[model samples]
Target: MSYQENYIKQLHTLLRLVTDSVEGYKSAAEHVDSTEYKDLFNNISRQRESIAAEFRERISGYGGNAEVESPDLMASLHRSWMGIKTAMTKKDDQAVMESCRNGDQALLDAFDDILQGDLLNNADLKTFIMDQRLKVNEVFLDLDDRYFKLFKKDPSI
Candidate 1:
């Protein structure tokens, strides 16, 4: 593929991942019973939506189609699994939090994959990706801390 094609492809991949994250967060918010958790997930979903918009703009600027025709297969399956798990656990808050944590980790992994690749050589794009990754990592860590606190408070969780 040409340089432009490769660059656009990378942006598309990021866009799809962020889009999946948005849906995943929204789903988590809906499934969880905690008002605080719901608010947190909804806020994160909005943040992810903004990031996805940036990716779309970058793809468009590169003369590539920015529209994601469908959700990634793996992400769709993950969401389905989350729903089933939530149901099985009877909408347990801990289970919902655990699923969200896993989804966030998947997102962070995608960011790491793209950042480690040489194809992302553009300085501006690289910086943008780094900034977004940091934001995601910050939230992931917060979620991790919260999960552990909850787990510690009640081992049964």
Candidate 2:
């Protein structure tokens, strides 16, 4: 593929992942019973919405069409699985938090892949991805710490 096409493809992939995150967090908010967790999930969903918007803008700037429709099927299935897991675990908050943590890790992994790949050689795009990745990593760390504390497990383990 040409350079432009390759970059556009990368942007689309990031866009899809961010969109999936938004939906995933929204689903988490619905599955959890705690008001605090619900609010947290909703807030994160909003943050991801903003990030997805930036991605859309960037894709459009490159003359590529952004997929503004529903997130992909995998994300849908994962969200459904989360709901089922929550039900099976009797609405356990820890289970929901763990799923959220996993989703966040997946997003971070996508960022790492793009950053380490040759297709993202543009300095401006690189900076944008790095900044976004840092924000996502911070969220992941917070969720992970909370998970360990809630389960009374040492993080070092």
Candidate 3:
């Protein structure tokens, strides 16, 4: 596969994870304790869904399968971890803090891979990837700040 082809496959995997993460977050919002956390999860879930739509379209435009070719291993694992943490917290904030850290790490890993890879020759995809990286970084940073404020120890973020 061309680098672009690999990227397309990777992106489809991302979309699949995003879809599952969105669903998980939505469930968290409805079943979680705090209204603030609920709202945050809901908003983030919607944002992820929107990103997934864009990814699907971009993949299809490239003559690739847009319907999520593979599972997002990291995100799926993160979701499971988050659920366990949610159950363990019992209204404490540590679990959510752990979740934030894991999410930050996942986003960072994803964007770092995209950033280090050579995609500049593909103008359209390169631009899109750059934009997504910036967006993902922004979200990660914001979540890190929130987690720091809530947890106040910087566990691993």
Candidate 4:
């Protein structure tokens, strides 16, 4: 693929990931019994929605179509998360937090893949990606801390 085509595809992938994140967070919010956890997930879901919308607008500016649905990769990830939730006692906040930690790590991995790729050669795109990456990193760390506080162990291990 041409550089432009590749760039647009990556953007679409990121957009779809953000959309999937919103849906995942919403479902996670519903699964948790704690009010604080519910609110946390709900707020993150809204933030992901905003991020997805921004991605769509940016892709449109590049004369490309934004993805209307999550990509197969993210779709499978979502299904896997749902499966994990369904197989367990869903009322557990610790389980929900564990799911969140997994999701956060996945998201950071996605961001890292893009940031380390050629897509960042475009300065504007680079700035945007870096900014988003920082935000994702911050949230991931916060989620890790919360998990640690609840479980008394690092989730990354």
Candidate 5:
């Protein structure tokens, strides 16, 4: 596969993971029964939607399907996150928050790598980077803050 193809595949994988995590957050919020938790869930959902849309636009630039879902991959990601969330919950609220932060950080780093690579030397990436890349970085910073605050309350909680 070409670099474009490989990069698209990785970005697609990451965006789908975002979608799954957002759904999990939404579900957890439903079960949370806490206003604060619900607010965070809703914010994550909105952010996920925006990030997914940006990724879709980027993928379409390569004349590929903007959104494709595979049963096996999707199911696997969902199941994996389910276990992750459960284990984080078993630890503490701070742990759960840190997990969310870590996930966002990973995605942000992936995109940054793509932007720095020669693949981004093209006009398409140049145009999009001037706009979308900054926005994505901002979102990453916000997500970090959202989770970091919880950890600040009690480092060991």
Candidate 6:
């Protein structure tokens, strides 16, 4: 495809991921019993929405149509799996954190691919993508620490 088409395609993919992240965070907030986790999820959800809005605006500036698509099948299945796992194990916090880590990893991978691609010669898009990549990497680091702290040692052992 043409360069512009490739750029629009990548932006749409990121937009979809951001939109799905908002929903995922909301779901996690609803399922987690901890008020701290709930509030954090909600705030992250809002921030994701703002990020998606920025993406939409950027897409429009390129004279491309900004379409809001449903989250991909894999993401939908991941959410369902998380819901079932949390319900069965009653490990809401762990399950939600696991899901968050997975989601963050997906986003980080996407950002990495976009940054590495030749499609990002556009300065504005490259800058935005890099900024997002940094933020996502920070989140992944925090989640990694949180996960290790929570489940590193088995209480039964």
- lDDT of every model, 2 decimals: 0.89, 0.85, 0.70, 0.79, 0.62, 0.80
Each candidate's TM vs. the true structure? 0.95, 0.90, 0.82, 0.88, 0.67, 0.88
Worst 10 residues of 5 by lDDT: 70-79
User: All predictions: root-mean-square deviation over Cα?
Assistant: 1.1, 2.7, 3.3, 3.0, 3.9, 2.0
Local distance difference test, candidate 5: 0.62
Candidate whose TM-score is highest: 1
Error of 4 at 138 (Å): 1.6
Error of 2 at 67 (Å): 2.4
Evaluate residue 129 in candidate 6 and report its C-alpha lDDT on the 0 to 100 scale.
75
Q: What's the number of clashes in each of the models?
A: 0, 0, 0, 0, 0, 0
Q: Write the per-residue lDDT of candidate 6 for residues 1-157, one digit (tens) a residue.
A: 7777888888888888778888888988888888988887788888888888888988887778887866766667767877887788685687788888898888888878887886557887899878766876876797788777677654541
Residues 10-129, candidate 1: write the lDDT tens digits. 888888888998999999999999999999999999999998998899899999999997887878888999999999998888898999889889888988998888656788888988
Model 2 residue 125 CA deviation in Å? 0.7
Score candidate 1 by lDDT.
0.89
Candidate 5 lDDT over residue span 1-157, tens digit each: 8877865775676567656656655654554445776687678767767767877887887766877575236434544675577565763445445555565565566556666766564666556644555655665587678767766776874
- Least lDDT summed over 10 consecutive residues: which range in candidate 4? 70-79
Give the per-residue lDDT of model 4 (tens digit) for 31-54.
888899999999989888888888
Q: How many clashes would you count in candidate 4? A: 0
- Scored by lDDT, the top model is 1
Clashing pairs in 6: none
Candidate 3 structure, TM-score to reference: 0.82
Candidate 3 residue 134 Cα shift, in angstroms, is: 2.0
Q: Compose the digit string of candidate 3's lDDT tens values, residues 39-96.
A: 8878878787887888889988878878765567777788777777777766455466
Residue-by-residue lDDT tens digits, candidate 2, 15-45? 8888988989998898888899999999999
